[model samples]
Target: MANAISASPTSTDPGRIGVAVIDQDGKRPVQISAQFAVAADSSTRFQIVVSDLTDATEEVALFFCGPIRDGLDLEEVNQGPLVLSQAPNSPARYDSVLGDRSECSYTTSRLEPGHQTIVVGQSRYSFLARTGANVLYTVPGVRTVLTREDLGGETMAPLDPASTVSITMAGLPNDLQIAAAVPQLPDSGLPSWSYEVGGQPRVPGEYRVMGHLVTVENRAQATVFFAGAFVGISGAAVLWLIEILVTGALGGRPRGEPADRWEQTKERPPPRS
Candidate 1:
């Protein structure tokens, strides 16, 4: 394994770089964790990693693409094609080589709702590249890790999160700035991958029909708690007038020790469908 595979950007891309590391290990199931550093121009760089396969000693074809739901093209999958920028001073680094998407196996669930089509993109240490005749190629990066190119690719079975990727963010431009700073990760306790492979449970837990319409002066109106994907609600609560959701001085540097802000903490109810 060479230690780190460098990332390259397109020539015509004149946008400034947003540096950040998206990291994860093979502790749990195949899950991804990411922390984004948004640049003023919103040019984002991501590091999707699966580490810990330094002990992987099996041979199997692997995948590196996303399981896109609605479907997407190569150009649409990545906008900068979202490459990892390797600055010499970056914290993250890799010792394995990237696997070509051309090698991975795929299975498509026909027109099925919540269907899947995996398109493994930029990957490392994953030996998905196949030979002309359909056979698992072999290579190693580290001692027992897959080779840079099997000429071919890895059977490092049961990949740990640190499967084969060690991408680093480098050459962070001197002028880069964070657009939005998240003081802490939210406790939402939800998986990063939004869509459930199989559609959500018919019901996550005990279910009951709740809420009802309020008829004031015979003008029926009701508020809702939540709505479903294709569900809709029409004659919900009628607001007296167009209302402001949040009010605060936006943009421009503030003056004095601290500026004041007016806020309404109450959230408008989700309309009943």
Candidate 2:
């Protein structure tokens, strides 16, 4: 029975990533240890687990940058709701049930003198997950270790006192820059993707929601090639025109002027006779 249970095909192992959350409510901040993993290859899956919530209805926001890929097309997967479960032994065990999911893409273009044309691809994902009857929530991925001292205590406050969580990736690319934003709480309802956050968004209270910014870059060589070809054609045309003008002046009949004196003389003698 033990061997049969261990060999079940329904099980999967998602790689672990480090993540940490800090609650900045009191004079001393409280840190919570969290774990995350990629659910599948077709889509980027992120799972976050924070233990011990003071209020089951309290909302927590997650913000981080996804792995950067080289391409113009920003690929995104449908995100599952923020799930809550008892402090599970593994991040993969958490279930996402109550939150909403969506997809979006952002782009910027640039033209440099010598470099190739670059189109910056940015895909950012953010959502609000309310705490449920349990403590675990599945929304994203990162890897870090936390202890009792870090979490402070079993009960931690939600987004308040302007708390911040930093996720560091080892061996990050040289050209990549990570950008994060904390959305402003809406007046009537939940926040939407349309609420743009330039660079980084700032809010007075702690940001209850957090998400990721996936930055990508795509270069097109056609623009530079076309520019070079245009410059070469223009130069050749200008030189050809200048040569025609110079040759005509040396022959005593510059461009736009009448025929040369010798031709005029030959025609005039026949007229006199």
Using alpha carbons, what is the TM-score of model 2?
0.25
- Kindly provide the TM-score of model 1 when superposed on the true structure, using C-alpha atoms: 0.18
- Candidate with best TM-score: 2
Model 2 lDDT per residue over 1-273, tens place: 212212211112122222222333332322333222222223332222332233322212232222211111321122222221223222222312111111111111111232112121221221122111111112322222222112213322233222233221122233322233234434533321221111122211122222221221222234446788999999988987887778756754434545665466443444555
Q: For each of the candidates, give the backbone clash count.
A: 32, 16
Q: Candidate 1 lDDT, tens digit per residue, 184-210?
A: 112542111121112212101110111
**Residue 86, candidate 1: C-alpha displacement in angstroms:** 20
What TM-score goes with each of the models?
0.18, 0.25
**CA lDDT, every prediction?**
0.21, 0.27
